[model samples]
Target: MATSRRVSRVAELIKREVSQMLLHDIKDDRVGAGMVSVTDVDVSGDLQHAKVFVSIYGTDEARAETMAGLKSATGYVRSELGQRVRLRRTPEIVFQEDRSIERGNRVISLINQLNQNRQIDDAVAIEEVDEFDDE
Candidate 1:
């Protein structure tokens, strides 16, 4: 079993190597069709497996295509990782779509909208209070 610190370091290295592969080494047309980024990586305690979270910006069709491309290139990516990072055994790579960023943006937008509405209500309440004071 690996310590948490070692596992985290491995995860970071994996993320970096995979990101570089996606940016320069990968030649799949489908992957190139959209903008893709490595968002995070989670590695097992035993360091036998790693889940790579990726965020892609594009239409639904393009996202689907990019995922397919990633899936098909998994073996290649794993091989590249083994070469880039030295370890007793290279962890298996699993690609996952990360939607946390999108969800966060949506939440922020809702919050902003609510704030604007509250400001409008506050203005109306102040006007009512002023009229009452005049009376």
Candidate 2:
């Protein structure tokens, strides 16, 4: 319970460190996408594994490249985390590309379009109803 919280904190710290490293320190060409953000981190209770959710803004190819770059650099990232976080054993980092934001935006856009269409239809229907009443 409490240990899980500690692990979660460490996971967040790792995410921050990794983000900073990617932004300023990493020199990999594959990581040269538009921007990458750490969205979520889930750490196991045993503190031996962490799942990192990352959101990338760019083309799909760029996102895939960034993911590949991160996967290749996981060992280096884990070592860096161990040095900075003072853990007995550094947890293995797993990268996952998150599309939740994209999905949410799509849903909102669909709702707005539907609402607009409904408004137009209602206006037409009301006009027809008034014409029939007059007749």
- Which candidate number would show the highest lDDT if scored against the true structure? 1
Measured by C-alpha RMSD in angstroms, how accurate is candidate 2? 1.6
Please report, as a residue range, the 10-residue window in candidate 2 with the lowest summed lDDT: 1-10
lDDT (10s digit) by residue, model 2, range 27-111: 8788776478889888888888889889989999899999998888888878877887878888888989999999999999999
Q: Tell me, what's the RMSD of every candidate?
A: 0.9, 1.6
Instruction: For residues 1-135, write the lDDT of model 1, one tens digit per residue.
Output: 999999999999999999999999999998987799999999999999999999999988999999999999999999999999999999999999998989999999999999999999999999999999999
At residue 7, give the lDDT of candidate 2: 74
Q: On a 0 to 100 scale, what is the lDDT of residue 79 in model 1?
A: 92
